[model samples]
Target: MGTVEDYLGGLRPEQAHALRRVVELARGLAPDAEEGTSYGMPALLVGGRPLIGVTAAARHLSLFPFSPAVVAAVAPDLEGFSLSKGTIRFTPEAPLPDAVVEQVVRLRRAELGA
Candidate 1:
């Protein structure tokens, strides 16, 4: 998709809804955030730094926090989940916790001192 809205529009209702939740959570936590694409996935930026991203994959949809520390802090609750340095892999069937996402955004913002 050329844009984040186009990407969201292309998914099934449930998947789109999950992606929308991530977007809403990111925006709510960082009102001045900008929306764009990073590495072909939709991303939200806080103070010009990448804060979060949502991407569609063959097996699952992913919402990446873009912070290794944030992912590490929440690793306990993320057992059995696949993750990389800045990305967490989850299916659209499992919606992301808004609270967790907000915490991540808050932590990242604090790290950025913005």
Candidate 2:
């Protein structure tokens, strides 16, 4: 998708709704971020750099904070979620918690020096 909206638009209703929550959370943290793409996934860009990304997969949604270190730092708070070095995967049924998302965004902002 060329934009975050386009990506979110193509998902199932529930998935889109779930990801919109994440998108809003990220936007709140980085009020000046622009809609963009990173690693071919829809993202929020700050200073033209990816701060966070959201995606809908076949069976899961993902939040990409663009930093493996940020994922590690928030590891303790992310029990039960599927985590990779740079992504956190969650289902719409088990949506990512707002606090966790806040932590991710803040950490990414710091990492970006934004």
Candidate 3:
């Protein structure tokens, strides 16, 4: 299976940079989280569960928090970003803020009892 770095390497430089920032945020929030592929995208695993997955699409990069509740928890802070039940879409030029990323990770971590 391809590794997270391999997945990031395949993306355009700007996309990779943006995704890397998200990965960094996750890592900072959950230092014990493991990096791997989950649901065919680069993911961080904590307490044996996937915390978040990131995908690079043609028009934007997507962050999958893997829980609709997590999205809803951060809904107010997600102004101007495209959000769905499981994903938040953003451009490389306007990636989600580190504060937003931390909020998502914290919410997921709490939900998982980690």
Best by TM-score, which number? 2
Candidate 3 clashing pairs, residues 3+ apart or interchain: none
Candidate 1 regions off by >4 Å? none
Summing lDDT over every window of 10 consecutive residues in candidate 2, give the lowest-scoring window: 1-10
Instruction: Write the residue-wise lDDT of candidate 1 on 7-92 in tens digits.
Output: 88998887888888878877887899887866667787766677778887778888777778988887777777787888877777
Q: What is the lDDT of candidate 3?
A: 0.91
Which stretches of model 2 miss by more than 4 angstroms? none
Cα-based TM-score, every candidate:
0.86, 0.97, 0.95
> In candidate 2, how many Å is residue 25 off?
0.6
Model 2: per-residue Cα lDDT over 1-114, one tens digit each: 789988888889999999999999989989999999989889999999999999888989999998999999998988999999999999999999999999999999999999
lDDT of each: 0.78, 0.93, 0.91
Model 3 clashing-pair count: 0
lDDT-superior candidate, 1 or 3 = 3
Poorest 10 consecutive residues by lDDT, candidate 1 = 38-47
